[model samples]
Target: MSMTLALRRSIQTTPEQTATVFHGRRQSFCRFGDRVARLASALRTQGMGSGDRVGMLGVNSDRWLEVMMGVWWGGGVLNPVNTRWSGPEIVYSLDDSDTGILLVDDHFLHQVEGIRTTARRPPLLIHVGEQAVPEGMLSLEALMAASAPMDDAHRAGSDLACILYTGGTTGFPKGVMHSHGTLWAIGIQRLAQTPMPGGSVALHVAPLFHMGGMGRALVQFIAGETHVLLSSFDAREVMQTIERERVSDLLLVPTMLQALITHPEFDCFDLSSLRRMVYGTSPIAEAVLERALDLLPHVAFTHSYGLTELGSATTNPPHNHGAQGRASGLSRSAGRANAGLAVKVVNGDGVELPRGEVGELVVAGPNLMLGYWNKPQETAQALRGGWLYTGDGAHMDGDGYVFIVDRLKDMIVSGGENVYSAEVENVIARHPGVMSCAVIGVPHPQWGEAVHAVVVRKPGAALEAPDLHAHCKAFIAGYKCPKSIEFREALPLSAAGKVLKRELRAPHWAGQSRQVG
Candidate 1:
C-alpha cells in the first residue's frame, strides 16, 4: 500500500487520536488529516501536478510531516532539501530536480533569497514560519485555512515518491529515487522486527530530511501512534521533551544520544516513559553504549544499518544488546538480514564470499530504491544483476549476523551524519593555498568520528587549519568541514599516485576492532 493510503487509515480509524505534538501544540488525527488535504489542494492550485517535485527545507515539526503527506497526496514527488546543506547546494538540488514549489520554515527562510538568485527556476515559496509570513512568500497557515480539503490522488506503489539527494563521489550530489512501495516496505519490515508499544509516544528529534528520521516517522504513522516533535536536536530540550511528553519510542543517532545521556541534567529528568531507542547512521562506541545501557536499563536499544538506496536492510535487535550481549560480542554485529530482504557479502566479481570473509555487502528486495534519479550509468553500476551493491565491506557469521569491517567507498560518518571525504576534498582542493588534501574519519571521543583533513600547502604558503575550515564551511555545511586539520608536507601515495587514505587512517585507528567507528 502507498503512504497516502496508509495515512488515510489513521485518519479514518483513529481520527480523534493525537497525531502530532510539536512543542506543546498537539493536533488530532482528524485535524492533521484536514490540514494535509487542504495543503494538498493548495499545492495543486500552485501548479503542482502528478509527479511534480515539491521541495521542503525545514526543521522537524508537525507542519513538516503535514507537508510530506500533502505532497504525496497531491500526486507530487517530494524533495526534502538537506537542512545542513549550504544555500548553493540546496539551489543545486532544486535546479537539478526541477522543483517548482518550496516550503521553508522560519529557521531556513534566510537562505531562500540566496537559493532564489542561484536556482535556474526560482521556486514558488511557502513560508511555514511561526511568525507572520515574510515578504515575497505565501503563508502555509493561510493557504491551509483558505483552501478546501480535496480528495486523495490515490497514488500508490511504484509511483515516483521521493528524490533524496546524497553526497556524490564526483563532487556533486546524486538524487536517490524511492517509490511509495519502497518506503512502505521498509517501515513494514522494521515493524516486523521490533513492534512499537501500544499507544506509543514517538519522539521526532532527528531532522525530518534524513531517511532515518523520515523512515521512523513512516513506521510511527502506520501504527497510528502520537508523534512528539522538536524543531531540532538539542541535548537539554530532548531530555525535557521526553519528560514532558512521556515519549515512549525515540529515533536518534549515537552522537545525539551521547549528548543527551552525558548532559549534566540528564539524571534529573524522569525519563521512565522511554521504552525503545533506535540508533544508526554510524557505529556507536562500546563505552558510549555501555554508559547508555547503565543509565537507561529499561530502554531497548536497536541498531539499524541501511543506506538511502536501501532502506532498513539490517537491524541489530534489542536482545543482542546490553551487558550480556556485549560480552558475547553479539553487539558488534549489524544483525541478520531484515525481514523479506536478502543480504549477502560478495567479492568484486559478484560472487558470494564465504561467511567469514569480508566483501562488499549487497542487498536485494522490494525495499531497494528505484535508482539514482536521471543517472542511468551510475544506477546501472550500483544496481548490478538485481543486487544493490552497498559500498560497505562486511562479513556474515555462521549465525547470519553481518559485521561491517570497512567502507568500500571513501565515506566518513561523524556525529551520526554521512560525510563524504571526496566532497570535502573537493572543497579543500579549491583553496588557492592548498596543494593537495586527503580527508578521513578519525577516532573521536564524543562524536564517534571527527572529520580530519591532511593538507599539503602550496610552496611558500602559510595556511592554517582555521583558514581551510572556514573556507569549506563557506560552501558546504559546517558539520562537513574538518573538525581537525594537519598541514602535511606530503600525503602517503600509492604506486598509482593516488593518495593512500588507508595509510593515513591507520595510525589514528590502530588497535580499534572495526575499521569503521
Candidate 2:
C-alpha cells in the first residue's frame, strides 16, 4: 500500500490519534490526513501528476510532512532538499530531478530566486513559514485553505516515491531513486526490528530531508505512533521534549548521542519514558554506548545499517545489545541484514569474500533503489548483477552479524597493508577528552598514505595531540595510531550525522584524485 493509504487507514481506525507534535504544534491523524489530501489536491489542480517531481525545501515542520504526503498522494515524487547545501549544489539536484513545483519553508525562501534562475524553473512556489508570505512566493497555508481533500488515487507499489540527494558524499550529489515498494519494505523491516505498541511516541530529531530522517519517520505511520517533532537537534531541547512528551523512541547518530550524554541538564530531565533508541548512519563510540547503558539501562537500543539506496535496510535487533551478548562484541557489530535483503562483502574483483574477512560491502534487496536518478551509466555501474555495490566495506562474523569496516574509498593502504579508518577512529574515540573523531589518509612521501586523525575534543577539555597518540598506541598497532592529529571545534557531518570524509580530506586531496595510493 502507498504511504497515503496507510495514513488513511490510521485515520479511520484511530482518528483521534495524534499524528505529530512539532515544536508545540500537534495534529491528529484525521486532521493531518485532511491536510495531506488537500495539499495533494492543490498540487494536482496545479497540473502536477503521476511521476512528476515535487520539491520541498525546509527544516523539520508539520508542513514538511504534509507536503511530502501530498506529493505522493498526487502520484508525484517527493524531493526533499537538503537545507545545508549551497545554491549551486541545490540547483543541480533540483534541475537534475526536473522538479516542477517547490514547497519551501522560511529559512530557505532566500534560495527560491536562485532556484528560478536554473535552466528550467518550477511553475509554482508555496512558501511555508510562520512569517507573512513573501512578495513572490505563494502561501502554503493559504493554498491548503483554498483546496479540497483529494480522492486517493491509490498508486501502485512499483511507482516512484522519492528522490533523495546525497552529497553528503565526495563528488557532486546524485539523486538516489527510491520507490513506494522500497519504502514499504523499509517500514516493515524497521517496524519488526523495534516492536512499538500502538501508543508509542517517537522523537523526530534528525533532519527530515536526509534518508535516515524519512526512513525512521515512516515507522510512525506504520505503527500509527505519535511523532514528537523537534525542528533541530539541540541536546537540552530534545531532553526536555522527551520529558514533556514522553517520547518513547527515536534514533540518533553517535555524535548526537555524545552531545546529549554530555548535556548539562541530562540528569535534570525525567527521561524514563524513553524506551527505544535506534542509532546508526555511522558508528557510535564504545564509550558512548557504555554511557547510554549506564544512564538508561531499560532503554532497548537497536543499530540499523543501510544507505539511502537500500532504504536503510539492515538492522541489528534489540535482543543483541548490551552486557547480555555484547561479550561477543555483537552489540557493537553493525548487525545482520534486514528481512528481504542480502548483504555480503566482496574483493576488488567483485567476488564474495570468506566469512570474517573484510571487503567492500554490497547489498541486494527489494529496498535497494531502482537506480540513480537520470544517470543510466551510473545506475548500471551501481546495480550490477542485481546487487547494489555499497562502496562501503564490511565483514560478517560466523554468527552472520555484519560489521562495517569502513568506506571503500576511505580505506588506507600503507606499506601494502590495508588500514580501515573506522578502526583507527574507533580507537581514538576511546580518549576521555575526545568528543568524536574521523580518520583519513593523508599523502605521505614514504608510506604513500599515512593515517591522520581529525578529532573533536570535549568542551573546555585539555587534550594534547601526544596524549591521544599515546592512547591509540596503547590499544592498537603503533602504525595504526594517527601519524598526525588535528583538532576541530566540531567534526563536519552530513544531514544524517555521518562524518563527511570528502569534506574532511578535501584540503589534502585537492591536488590529487584522492590521497591514498
Candidate 3:
C-alpha cells in the first residue's frame, strides 16, 4: 500500500483519536484526514499535478505533517528543504528538482525574496503560519478551509514519493529519490521490528527535513500513533513536553540525547512517562550512553544505522543495551540487519568480507532509493550489482553485529598506515575530561598526513595532548594515536548530530591538491 493509504487506514481505525499535537493545538485523525484531503484538492486546483514536486521549508510542526500527507494524497512528490542550508543551497535544490510549489512558515518566509530571485523558475508560495500571509503567498488555512475533501490518489508501489538532499558535509548535496513503496516498506519494516503501544503518543523534536526524523514520523504515522511536535530542539522543552504530553515514543540523535540528559533542569522534569527512545546519525559516545542509561532507566534506548538512500538498515534493540549489554559490546554495535534487508561488508573488489574484517558496507533491499536525481553517473557509481554501496567503513562480528569504524573517505592514511578515526575518537572519549572529540588527517611534511584530533573538554575539566597520548597508547598503536591535538570549545555538527569531519579537514588541505595519501 502507498503512504497515503496508511493515513486512510489510521483514520478508519481511530477517527476520533488525537492525530497531531503542536503547542496547545490538537487535531483528531478524522479532522486531520479531512484537512489532508482538502489540502490535496486545494493544491490540485492550484496547479500541482501528478508527479509534480512540492517543497516544504520549515521546522517540525503539525503543519509540516499536513503538507507531507497533502502532497502524497495529491499524488505529488515531496522535496523537504534542509532548514540549515543557506539561500544558494536551497535555490540549487529547488532549481535542480524543478519544484513548482513551495511552502514556508513565519520562520522561513523571509527568505522568499532571495529564493524567488535565485531559482530559475520561482515556485508558488504557500504560507503555513498563523500570521497574515505575505503579499505574494497564499494561506494554507484559507485553502484547506475553502476546498472540499477529495479522494486519495492511491499512488503506490514505485511511484516517486520524495527527493531528500543529503547533508552535504563533504560537498554539494545530492538529491536522493525515494519511491512511495520504498518509504512504505521502510515504515513497515520498523513496525515489524517493534510494535507500537496502544494509543501511543510520539514526540517529534528532530527536523523533518532529515531522513532520521522523517523516517521516525513515517513509522509512527503508519502505526496510528499520536504525534506531539515541537518547533525546534530545546532541551527544556523536550523534557517538559514528555512530562506534559505523556509522550511514549521519541527520536533523538546521540548528541541531542546527551544534551537532554545533561540539561541543567533535566532532573526537575518528570520524564518517567517516556517508554522508548530512538537515536542515530552517529555512534553514541560511551560516556554519554552510560549517563543516559543511568538517568532514564525505564526508557528503552534503540540505535538505528542507515543513510538517505537506504532506509532502516540496522537497529540496536533495548535488550542489547543497559549496563550488562554494554559490557558485552553489543550496545556499541549498529545491530544486526532488520527483517527484509540484506547487509554485508565488502572489499574494494565488491567481494564479501568475512566477519570481523573492515570493509565498505553494502545494503540490498526494496527500501533502497530509486537513484540520485539528475545525476546518472553518480547514481550508477553508487548503485552497482544490485547493492547500494554505502561509503561507511564497518566490520561485522561473529554474531552479525555491525560496528562502524569511519567513513571510507574519512580514513586517515598516515605514513602508509590506515587509521580509522572512530577508533581513536573512542579512546579519547573515554577520558574523564573529554566531552566530545573528532579525529581527522591533516597534511604533514614528512608523513604526508598526520593523525590530528579536535576535542571538546567537559566543563571545568583540563586535558593535555600528552595525557591523551598516554591513554591512546594503552589501547591502540602509537601510530594510530593523534600526532597533534587541538582543543575546541565546540565542533561543527550537522542537523542529525554527526560530526562534520570534512569541515575539520578542509582548512588543513586548503592549498593542497591531494587529499589522501
Query: For this target, which candidate reaches the highest TM-score against the unseen true structure?
Result: 1
Which one wins on lDDT?
Answer: 1
Cα TM-score of candidate 1: 0.98
Residue lDDT tens for model 1, 133-197 = 88899998888888999999988899989999998877789999999999899889988887976
Write down the lDDT that model 1 would get: 0.90
1-517, model 3: which lDDT tens digit per residue?
6998879998999999999999999999999999999999999989999999999999899999999999999999999998766677688889989999999999998889999887999999999998899998999889888999999998899999999986332334589999998998889988777668687889998788888789889998898889999998889999999999999999887657877988899989998889988877654556677889888899998888887887779888999997778898888788888889999999999999999998999999889999999888879988998999988889999988898776675666554344667667877899999999998988765455679999999999878888999987765557778999999999999999999888998899787634221
Residue pairs with backbone overlap in model 3: none
Clashing pairs in 2: none
Off by over 4 Å in 1: 515-517
Ordered from best to worst lDDT, the candidate numbers read: 1, 3, 2
Give per-model TM-scores.
Answer: 0.98, 0.80, 0.81
| Residue 196 lDDT, candidate 3, scale 0-100 | 81
Which residue runs does candidate 3 get wrong by more than 4 Å? Answer: 167-170, 410-517
lDDT of 3 at 421: 76
Better of 1 and 3 by lDDT: 1
